[model samples]
Target: MKIRKQLPISALIAASALISTQAMAEVFVAPFGGYSFGASDFSITDEKTDELGSLKISESNHYGFMAGVTTKDPGDIYFLYSHQGTELRSGGSFSPNVITDLNVDYFHLGGSLYFPNGNLKPYVTASLGLTQMRPGDNYSTESRFSMGFGAGIEYQMTEAFSLFADARGYATFVNSSSALFCDGGDCLWSISSDIMWQGQANLGVKLKF
Candidate 1:
């Protein structure tokens, strides 16, 4: 009878310890704004004339937010959503000269590996996600698989807040089909490349809860 009573008490203590350890894990959200550049240029060709042209996505500002939970390791797993509004310009007689209103968005699931020292932590991050490209007017939106890799440093200001900056490079796989950016049988552009690339630099504040 005493052993049965002691077993219940022991189980209660074990459960309490597990809960306390979980409670010590940190949850954080970071809202960030950044400049994105180095978007790859696509080659365009006139099917009948055999003339070559070029298409470019302009450099622009992007914003995003990340929410994550710290693991037992000195790292965290996060979900990131970022968006950029820019222009697509055409050169060498590929028809429309410029699409002034274009948007690029990324939805990513990523993780960071951290090296901590005092109040500062330097980390490397990698993510895989989808990239959505939307152009204004009659153009259709295109979604492609993408990945990113980056490195950054964070300075902890207090127990609940920190500042961070990161530079990341993204690679988006272009569709193999010719139907991209098309609406109602009219196509805005087509390219032969398998991948498009871009780079970004971000600064943000991390809030912990």
Candidate 2:
């Protein structure tokens, strides 16, 4: 991703207000990197049997890209893919032990509604998608239906380039009462909640063509 030096906030706002209003449809791709955190804990069971203990998803850094088209309505319809590789740990009162490595990924089709202020635009976005959880140690991967929502802003630096940032929360629906991450008849864990929640924040440069 290409990043530019920062400009004074007053100059940015002033220049944004002075920019001409012309509507043109465009296509854009944004590559972003950020941190992922605040994932809800899961209840672990051994071999689809008794509950062993609680497990927590560790906070980690993630990266993704968004590709979409700009609408004449001054908004964007985009597809987003994000990924984080973290560990699941056994929860303890003192210190937790790393249980295994886990990878969380999101694939979504989403849209953003922009509130344009000249060269600066703030937007609200929402998406419906699937979340894939892959665990190490020969555990089976699981995919669940998920949804996300967020708000962010973009600064248009040029006709074909911009900078954007956003924070989004995702919820993946899972069977809280049943076994999960199973390979064959052997299952590793079961979640405590019917919905697993996680959040991410991203910053990137957008290229429009």
Candidate 3:
């Protein structure tokens, strides 16, 4: 279930109004939790290419933290970390005991372009990071290169607090590899490293000091 998602363009146009403006430089921290949806599917088949069965990960939730500074022109440079876990369900009649826990963790550095001074601020964000994926117990973690971008708005609620919402999608470059459930030299299915994506609609709070 790989769905290619395009970055929202409407918000990019809205945020362009701040290009010529100036903003403040300050430190802030935001801790957020939100619902997340997984879109990665693993299928099993005979080595000769016969479709045997498949598995899909279920929707899950995520929580993370960002801490960084607001610089001139109101841009933000932040460090981020997040965790998500999903359950693998049978998509076809593979193996009943093949159901397992799938987990992903992200460690990234992000930057955003924003308007300096406004009750309602629009911004665009892009980040480059590392993603760690765990398929099941006793298996080595898979590390991959990941990147994401999106746009959103933040409304100042007080001198030190603000509310924000954004929609973004991330792609993990998994490439192609042998399955973790393979037996001996004969594997059931070969996984493609194409693009494993997850889309997020998040609501959170930012505290500026």
Q: Which candidate gets the maximum TM-score versus the true structure? A: 1
User: What is every candidate's alpha-carbon RMSD to the true fold?
Assistant: 2.5, 12.5, 13.2
Q: TM-score for each prediction?
A: 0.88, 0.82, 0.75
Provide the lowest-lDDT 10-residue window in model 3: 1-10
Return the top candidate by lDDT.
Answer: 1
Compute the lDDT of residue 169 as modeled in candidate 2: 97
Model 1: lDDT to the true structure: 0.88
Looking at model 1, residue 88 earns an lDDT score of 84
lDDT winner between candidates 1 and 3: 1
Total clashing pairs for each candidate: 0, 0, 2
* Model 2: worst 10 consecutive residues (lDDT sum): 1-10
User: All candidates' lDDT scores?
Assistant: 0.88, 0.85, 0.75
Off by over 4 Å in 2: 1-23, 44-49, 92-95
Candidate 1 runs further than 4 Å off:
1-17, 46-50, 92-97
* Candidate 3: tens digits of C-alpha lDDT, residues 1-209: 12322344555655665653434557899888887776666655545666576656677898888899887756789998878887666666665444668787888899999864569998999999998877675445668899978788999999799998887788877656565344344454666436778777778899998
**Candidate 1 per-residue C-alpha lDDT over 88-169 given as tens digits, one digit per residue, 9 for 90 to 100:** 8876666657755789999999999999999999999999999999988877888999999999999999999999999999
